[model samples]
Target: MGDTGMPRAFIPRPSPCAPPSPISVFATIDSPPWTLAMSTYGYENCVAGTFYGFTKTEFNPGDTFSLQWGAIDDGATPLNITLGRAGGYIIDEIIVGAQFTKTSALYQLVVDDTANCTLEEFSWAIPDDFNTTDPQYQIGLFNASVLLGADGVPLFGWQAWNPDFYVRPVSSTTTTDASSTTSTVAATATGGNTTTTTSATSLSTFSASPTSSSVSDDSTSNSETIGIGVGVGVGVAALAAVLLGAFYLRRRRKKAQTPSQGLGGVRQQYIQELPATEKRPPMHELAG
Candidate 1:
């Protein structure tokens, strides 16, 4: 028998390992695919590090994955970056590293798909009123949409500790008068005696050498005396005529009655002709 470990026929074919040509190994490691994007703004000159316990591939709640700086204004002054809750970590707080002035700030949210080996990133801006003490600023693993709340739902409840100052509204009134020469006068009168008077004097000449003078006085007094006089002119002829007419009428009546008295017989005849009830009608007849 030939030696057990020895080759029977030494057939040396061309050596396959004769200095293999340089083969470049191209790496095709597929990176995780991005599913969602989240971002924030307003942070400038912030240090780059693992914030909110989020690694380069992890996300946390309330995470500002990416960051951008905004201008200095009454709104959020500093931009913040942190892990988003989409991945699993509940963000309980936010840490702002630097202040920002002028320029928009931006941030992004990123997540890693462990099963599919995919990475997701979403972008967003820090809100205008974003502040550490702002009520809207919340932490913990909560849905962004849910945290923002719906139409009827309440938003965050954190109150800003810093007080904001504002100017108070002012009101004014104005009054104007049209006439310049108009005057207002107020007077009070008291006690027993008070007098008010107005006076005016004037002179006029209708012809040469004409002269005129006048005086007027109005007075009030406690006691006053007034005198009145009447003058009568007597006429002897008028008086005598009235007396003579009176005397004539008396004489005529006397003469007429004398005849009547002397003629008693005629009188008696006239009287006998008269009726006893002639002077008055009977009571029943008078009533009718």
Candidate 2:
């Protein structure tokens, strides 16, 4: 073993159940030295004949990126590079000595592990704290198994896909605090989020609240008109009823006067026809 406490890899014998092996008892365990590199937007420093992969260069808070790695060979175990198992690190994208992973965690994207198969691939999404200005995030080969050399350093064997690249953040333009009168629509929304616009035509925005207000005004005007029409109709009906009542009373009075006058005239005519002698009547019977 090297000075480090880690143990070096060695060849293993065949199965005990098999017949006596004809091959030599001793063999050389040929392996390479440990290597570490970084990747960033439009840049990567990968060791020859190693397993590492990455899919995208830019992303937003919740966007996803694809990743892949090569499988470990037989009779070898992957080195656990993370000081904390299941944890890892990333290099700076824009500034030296700066940590890109300081803003967010690099998650492993894998489906199966029953067999640490080679040529595996997976995906991961950019975390909420992922920086947008310098968007590239680099990570070591996930799910890749490495052999520990005598120096206790991890060494890669083969790779399946590209290991490093840049992921650009999605750009957008939004508006907030937009208020407009009922006359004209404006280019703003309630949630304070707005779409990117180049010209006035592109920002032809509308507001439901303002439209509803106008509709309410029209409804009030219509209600007033309806109320006036009802009042006029009621007044006309009342006048017509009054005139009809007056005409009916006058006709009844005229009919009653006509009958009385006719009776008086007939009585006068009969008296005149009687002559003066007939008028004396039995008054000749005198004072008896």
Candidate 3:
């Protein structure tokens, strides 16, 4: 199997930690298939960038089959490989010297340990006629993770792109049409808090734009309230100081003024008046 390009036939092995549980995420058609050629890999109608290789393009009901590949970073850095809902095993980037040996980090998914090479199969069997009413009718693989930064900003891992293979009626629908949903999670870290969101929506030319004006408005309102509170406190303090100064000046002026007494009331004579009855007459007579 290593020499040839084909994978060897073997029983599906269980994961060491835990088997990937089948999730309800469905496959979506990002762009029209015309943009992506049958022979070449194109980024035409894809929402998130991915490299895919599957055994068959079309399948039927009750068919036992599998889609296998590795999760490569089309954009996000530190590319991580998760089993996801596709129920695949983790493997190391292989490098084999053979005519048809697939030796790419982003190509075929395989095991790192040669001793445990047999545990590298991502297999799934198709169910009978699927219920038409159910929106999630197709099965797919997803590479998803949320990265939190110290600034409360969120970075994403491999984006939730469409899977390699989708199970659907061949004639009824030529292209896969999967519905996408967004889930928001509140995440708190040691330094700051962040809001993590996982969305499967395709990145189209006319993708929906979110409104951040509400958050801005709330922040603005809070700032205004704080400013008003501070202004009011300062004004009140200034007014109290002015009132206290005015009262103190009035009390000092009242104390400085001398009190006067009526004729019947006894008052302290600061200066005693001597007998001045003959003084003016004697001066006038002597001058004459």
Best by TM-score: 2
Task: Give me the runs in candidate 2 sitting further than 4 Å from their true place.
Answer: 1-206, 278-288
Provide the overall lDDT of each model, using Cα atoms, as 2-decimal numbers. 0.28, 0.38, 0.35
Compute the lDDT of residue 156 as modeled in candidate 1: 25
lDDT of 2 by residue, 1-288 (tens): 223222223323234354321221112112221111122223233232244544344345665544434323321322121111111222311111111121112212222333333332223445556555644434442122223231344222212224444544444411221223411343352333343333333445444557879999999999999999999999999999999999999999999999989999999999999877544535355474
Which pairs clash (backbone N, Cα, C closer than 3 Å) in model 2?
Answer: 51-159, 53-163, 57-166, 57-167, 57-168, 58-167, 58-168, 71-118, 71-119, 78-146
Q: Which RMSD values do the candidates have, in order?
A: 35.8, 18.4, 22.0
| TM-score: model 2 vs. ground truth | 0.29
C-alpha RMSD in Å of predicted model 3 compared with the true structure: 22.0
Summarize candidate 3's per-residue lDDT along 60-156 as a digit string, tens digits.
Answer: 5555544333323332222223322232322211111101112322222333332322111233344465332322222322222222111232212
Candidate 1 lowest-lDDT run of ten: 165-174
Compared to the true structure, candidate 1 yields what TM-score?
A: 0.14
After superposing candidate 3 on the true structure, give the runs of residues whose Cα lies further than 4 Å from its correct spot. Answer: 1-211, 258-288
Q: For candidate 1, write residues 1-288 as lDDT tens digits.
A: 111231122112223334222111111112232322223232233222212213233222333333211122222222222222222222332332223212212112232223211111213323333333322222221112112222333322111111111111111111222222221211122122223211111111333223322111122221221211111223556788899999999999999999867799798989999888756755665564
Clashes of each: 46, 10, 1
Please give the lDDT score at residue 239 for candidate 1. Answer: 82
